[model samples]
Target: MNQDTPMLPSIEPATLEWREGQPVSARFGDVYFSRENGLEESRYVFLAHNRLPERFANLKAGDTFVVAETGFGTGLNFLATWQAFRDQAPSGARLHFVSVERYPLTSDDLRQALSLWPELESLADELCEQYPPLVVGNHRLVLASGDVRLTLYFGDALEALGELTFEADAWFLDGFAPACNPGLWNTSIIEQIRQHSRPGASLATFTAAGYIRRALADAGFAVQRVPGFGPKRDMIRGDLPPDGQNTGDGNGSILVVGAGIAGSLLARNLADRGRTVIVADRGEAPGTGASGNAQGALYAKLGVQFNDQTRLSLAALLHAQRYYPANTPRVWHGTGLLMMAGSEHERLRQQKFLQQNEYPDRILTPVSAEQARSLTGVPCPHGGLWFPGSGWLEPYRLCTTLLDHPNIRTEFGFRATRLLPCNNRWCLSGEGRQDLIADAVVIAAGHETRKLMPVLGEFRMKAIRGQVTSLPSGALTATPKAVVAGTRYLNPPMNGLAVTGATFDLHDSDPQERLSSHQENIAGLESMIPGLLSCDDLASSVSGRVSFRCTTHDYQPVVGALVNGDGRVLDGAWLFTGLGSKGLMWAPLLAEHLADCLTGQPAALPRSLARRVDPKRCLAEPVDTGVPVG
Candidate 1:
């Protein structure tokens, strides 16, 4: 898929009405919940039928349970389940709730609809705060201090469910009335659900249609009819009997090499999902590599012509914009970003990006020179593209914050030099000595990863050095209110300092800060904003940092299972390197994807985008697994 491919159309927001003070979907011509008492009806139909209260109470320490639902109308069921899990679940237990919605309600609609139930206000507000866009893909929201996880797939039910990689512990079959929305209850969707269900998994639905019962039974469920809530007399419930089918939730220990943003994010992802994670780094602390930069810009790097690289970058940027704020101000700043039209060629490219894609203004808007200056509080030479959700953050702060999770342990100065597999486990050794042993290992040491995995050389990875110059805020006439990027970037001031200038030197490994590169950065900055800074100010500036960034020829990160020269997958081994300069934007998304691959959870990206970053894509030879690399 390329830029010429049409953008995935967003799901139309549900048009809702009021029926006896309860919200009703006009499209389906059905009430969202029982008009008699929506809260009680939800409790009776979903929670009671699924035995959630008992399950929550029985969860042992370090256990994780997943509950999947078909329709996430107003997120009432999710909130109810979250509240129950919070009130009754074991202290260290985790809850993963996955839901699918074809037509999601707008934020305003959800707020208005949920207002009827003041009892669910807390959870509703949390959901609203992290609500995702209406795009056709997955949005994983980690809530309640990383204890409750919500994965919302917005698209057709069958297509969305078919892409998921995890097995559900319980299913909530609630997609309007089966008669009104038969597509969601079709045999194919049911079969997909069955295939993605863990053995002994139970399902509950407020409908007892004969065909539904027969279809579920035919798919290997022990179906039964139970009393329904409200006026309905009967509801359907089923259990996938054990019979050696259940794949119990057991996440093994994982050792992540490199404490940079990539490794930190991967550790957080694994630890949040109940896996014990050990992070090892060659340096004395985290973010000592490229991720140690004072400030890194976060935005989708697009080209005049869209390619697989641009698509993956866009997806990663979108997910990062939404997910990075789970820990705001302390780690990130949502001050917005601006890409200046510094050159005529880039101005034309920016115009093409806007004309080719009908992106939401909030995501990317073409701003006039005057508008850009007013919005950013800086003098601008030309109109540029503004990303309201994009911003910059200190990479080290964010990496450390992510590693603060209870399930994550950090081993600084423990450089992993070799990955040796023994007895179905991986032993990561550093300097000819075993440093850590784990069931799985991920090599994420940026450019240095090539030394640990020689096969990575086949992918043509390069280490490019970058230097960023920082100046005291007083050096500028006025501080920019947002990040301004073009040939260089002038980030919003933080702690009385503003940062700009990153000279991308290909094939350079020197970490020494250079005055020549600093001058080049200033030249680029002046080219972007004509009179923003004078040569005297740049000459006086002395603070800067130089770090090595890893990149691949295709400009895509290498993720997924690591394969040997013989075209065999190294079991329990993964590679997550080659992020290059976009580490800030790509780390969180790819880390989550790697976590999903390891834990057998739903992938957060589409197959097309996922394949573009597959570790096997750059193989010297592509093997025919007949599995399309998904």
Candidate 2:
């Protein structure tokens, strides 16, 4: 399918009319109260029927309840729930409200509708602030100082419910009346909801329709008719009979293949969450992937105009700057980085962006060659945009630090041959005779994921073999304080050696360990820093490593749930690969995102951005271009 075509189903808005102090509507042919009545109906039918105030008071400290809703119209239900939770629930208890909305109203409409609740102004304001970018998929909004979390699924109600990985303690069946919205009241939807309900999960809705009650009863819920909220005569309330059997909460174990930055960081985050994680790699040690380089620069290449890649890169850069640890051997020097101004057109674009976006002044500054030398401690013929927050990091050391987590187990020389999904777990076969069973698995093994999982189809990944040459620090006029970029990138001395030039070669995948590429790297370095070093000086300092870097056409790292044929993620099978060269900056944040999704916590990044990183996204949509090999 092309980009212009919709990948998923879409819905139309319901028709509305004002009736007897209630705004009524017909959604999917089902009658519903659009505004006033809908808001009040939710407050009484859903909240009151669940006995929320009493339940909230009884919750233990730090305990959280998952509340799933059939529909999220105008978000009145959510706002009301938040208000009640804040007022009645103990400070330590958290309220997680997950709602499915097909046709979400625009921000303006939501704001106007929310204005009717004068007493709920504070809670409404919090909701409006993190209302998300309105793009499809899951959007998590943190409210009440992060105590309450609202996860909005903007798509088909059934499809959205399927994507949810949480077991609800309560359910709000507040879609349009059963007759008006048969899709919401159908047996299939009820069965799916029941599948995600924990024992004793309570449910309530304003309609006591017989079909709805029957569907609920058939789906394991004990249903009953109750006094309706407001002027209505009746409503429906149900509960999942207590199992009295605790199916011990299973420990979610994940096997992350490849110990590069991506896998190591993934291990770190999982370990932090008290998960038993194993990082497997064929190499003798970690960072033996493309991350074996001595020093790698950190900065986003600002495009002429902000495209999707540029926006993603900018967000990734900022996220890295804020979260990536600074105290590690990865030296973070505030000495700034210089992106040499080449063409007149490019310089103008940079100038325009500087005017519009208020970037951190201490981080980015436009400078001339003279100013650049004064700040960088080295002379340069061309001036460029200086990014002070950007600096060099020892990639191997960062990878090691990330893998240093106590719970992370690293097994070397374990090359995975096949993955089989069996009985709610993944069995990974390799050098070991017994298959390794895990609740989850992340394939951070780069371009090799395709070979491992043929079912993934074709991914837009290129294994670009790169070789970097290191020049001795003594060859320079003065040890450069900052990293210099253009056709070639030169970093300041780390351990008396300056590293530069990773000549990207797509024709070769086998590790050749070629001298020609090292010579090309030296030549490129000389062009960047004129008269600083001779061929002999550069070649003498040429002592760096080489590895294949896997990248996608869009340059965004894949990081999320892996969809499988059985409507479940092949037991524990997952992929964290295709990071390519930007792994240094992208791994930490993306790892956290994957960890959050696995733990059922609110995602840290925007839903659109998260989908862009999802491994399955490219499976459905093909990427037609390759980013220029740097």
Candidate 3:
């Protein structure tokens, strides 16, 4: 796949309508059917027949079940199921509903249709708020305060089902009647459904046609005839026997190498879920990777129009700012951020975006160069967007705080040299053959992950060495109230020292601290803040540290499941690397996403943005030209 090509499935168009005073919905074009019965028809034919209330009774804390559906017109069946689950299940249990819909109704149409159920209004509102963009492929939405996850495969049911892998606890065969939609009821679709069913998985549908029963039986379901809900005479209900059980859940133990932000955050999330996780790194303590910087700024840049990268950055910035802790040992001064108008075109573009959208004016402001100087306590050639909520974070301190949770065990000075899969478990080996095993593993060792997984050797992840120079506060009479950005960035003085950086070296990988890069960084800062101080005086108080940042071809971080061996196996392993210079702004949210996928919890970020960070795409495609390289 080309880097520019979007990894989304195609969607087909279809129409839906509700039968007035009737409980049925009629889909037009490829499938046409009516809920000839009332809403009770859905309850009896879909819910009771599948024995859902009883299944809910069996759920325990942290338990999750998957439900697969053939059709999702109007989402009535989903809404009903969500309401039922919310009323019946235990507090901590989660439900994942995987539904396929070739054509999805507009938000307005959904609101109108759902208006028939006044009781479901609140849930309907949540759904509308998180509705996916009118695009194809899998779109995930979080509902009911993150307990109910909905993954909508908006495309051909058969093709989309083929792309999904799930162990469903129940199946809602709510597609149009067999006669109206034979393509959906065919044996091929039934077989695909059978592939995802777990042992004793029950299924319920409103149809009792002969071919439907025969096809389902042939596809592995033990079909039974049951009295239909409402006026319908009969319906089909049954269960699929268990295939084979593989221990994909890493409940026993796991080894995570790299104690930086990625590995430490992963450890915290896993430990919170009661999993025993050990975080290891070569350094004597955690956060010694690229995360050891004194301070890093958080901000998102937008291009002229909404492109893929721009959209992704916007979504990430929103999600991260909402979730990252507001109070920590590390200083979090909302010093805001200043993105100078380096060019006239950029200034015009920023102005246009501000005028078009009702974005938080408190977070962003347009000002003149003199006004920018007043706000930031520095001289600027041009004014640009000012983000008030933006600030700097002590990366090392935050990483250590995330590891402070009791469930997370840390092991320093243990560098992982090899990762091998043995007996359906991953074993990390190094240092005199000391090994630790786990049902699942994550490779977050920055650029070193490619070395461990040879299949990813061809990926475009590069290690760009960088150095940040620290100068005495005497260089500036007044500390900046905000971080200033243009060609370089300068943070407000902290503890009598102001940090400014960083010099980028694309050709270097060695971690050796270089004086030349430090000098260059000081020069870069002077260029951004002219008349601040001379290089000679700044160099006298300057100190620096070097680190390498992992970067992907597209500048987005790799944060999902790993694809290995010619796509034959989606190795239980995952990744959370390639954060590059945006670690402070992107890591917290990306780590939350990886945690959601692991715990089967609802993702906080948009599905489109999530795909941009999926680790599998890195192995499948070449470098993306969408990112701007400095």
Best by TM-score: 1
lDDT of 1 by residue, 381-489 (tens): 8889989999988998888888998889888878566778878998877774456899988999999987887353365578998998887787777679899988888
- The C-alpha stretches of model 2 lying farther than 4 A from their native spots are 1-250, 326-334, 343-349, 355-358, 432-434, 454-456, 534-537, 563-571, 620-630
| Tens-digit lDDT string for candidate 3 (510-560) | 687677777787777776666786436556457878888899887778887
Per-candidate TM-scores read: 0.93, 0.62, 0.65
Ranking by lDDT: 1, 3, 2
Residue-level error in angstroms, candidate 2, position 272: 0.8
At residue 397, what lDDT does model 2 achieve?
79
Q: What are the root-mean-square deviations of the candidates from the true structure over C-alphas?
A: 3.1, 10.1, 7.9
